[model samples]
Target: MTITYEETRELAQRTVVDARYPNINIYTLDAIWVLYDRVLRVDPQRIDDPARDRFLLSKGHGPSAFYAVLAAKGFFPAEWLDTVADLESPLGSHPDATLVPGAEISSGSLGHGLPLGVGVALGQRATGHRDAQVYVLVGDAELDEGSNHEAIAYAGAVGLANLNVIVADNDSASHGWAGGIASRFAVNGWSTATEDMHDHDALYRAFTAPHPDRPHVTVATVRT
Candidate 1:
């Protein structure tokens, strides 16, 4: 059963209502939904397959959007949304990779996802999983972490063509990038695209655009 956008929104709202933390912002909802519904090649059933695309949610503090998308995609039961953050619930404010069916990593510690994604992309190449792609979704504010800068430079230096980064820029950064977030990646030899985060078709095109010899970064600017 294919879940429509309206259904996905309802699922997110359900989780939001059950949220115990104040950070359950649904800012990443549209981008996450678009990725799972249109772009990513990951399957809910074969999550452990080496050929599956890996999506790491680096900005994991507010994960209601993530959980909702996973549920809508059949990665887990929608009922879990009602119990989110409960003592015995698998769903928490931060997603647990082991607890969540399709999660690639246990995140929430800002700035780790991109670095881990670089390692995962390298591992895929080393293990002959050439067809797999590694994607990391991060927040603009999380980019303030030095670890991400290092990872961005390293990934670019190695020409990790199989790696893709989606930056959900809500302009929350303490020190904004001079030429915009996309320019930071572009200077590091990455193919870059900037689009409105709510523009599904534009998001699809940017995500699917080829960057043959380099990694890619799609800057999804959220409308305020």
Candidate 2:
């Protein structure tokens, strides 16, 4: 089931306000609202539109946020979000692109989203929707895994500027890992910026800004 955009907004905001989803990150859910309300262009009905920008929440622990936004956007029925992640539901703990109308990637493992975004961008190019963007969200904790670096570098060097990387850096990865992520993105030739993800205005500005080159990386320093 899915929800209407207005209803989705109410449920998500209310859930966080009531503390219903304890395991779910409040800011992540907030980010979902930002995406659904302003950023992502996913159609309420035609979710698979080729020209639509695909948003992959690479940090999959934030499933609740995604579900809330999807329901709000009327992907199915708003009430069905309550059953999300349950045994009988189409929406599981991690987003499955096949089951969820707006989901573009099945995620949770963390290290694969950047590459997945790259692939999506490539496919869009092949299909002649070169103007479409493939946006991916990554977790700071997950950045400790070396696999992400390769994908990030690849997106940069390959000139996949249409693929946007939004890294939610909570600053808790190992000892020094998170500290250097933004700098690394810059050194690798990725047009990058670091901003407080909680600030809706800042987030919108950073994400919507054009990349000076191919492969843009926006490090959103969020607190949990």
Candidate 2 achieves a global lDDT of 0.74
Q: How many residue pairs clash in each candidate?
A: 0, 11
Which consecutive 10 residues in model 1 have the weakest lDDT in total? 16-25
List the candidates' TM-scores in order: 0.96, 0.87
Cα error, candidate 2, residue 6 (Å)? 9.9
| lDDT for each residue of candidate 2 in 1-224, tens digit (9 for 90 to 100) | 44454565566554331135454454565456666678877787787688998888888865766777776777767666666666677777677778887788888787888777888889998999887877888887788777888987887787777888888777767665644678878877788878887787787887788874678877887765
User: Best-fitting candidate, measured by lDDT?
Assistant: 1
Q: Kindly report which residue pairs in candidate 1 clash with one another.
A: none
lDDT by residue (tens digit), candidate 1, 17-95: 3345654578888889888998888988788988888899999987888898999999999998988878898888788
Q: How close is candidate 2 to the true structure, as a TM-score?
A: 0.87
Report residue 59 deviation for candidate 1 (angstroms). Answer: 0.5
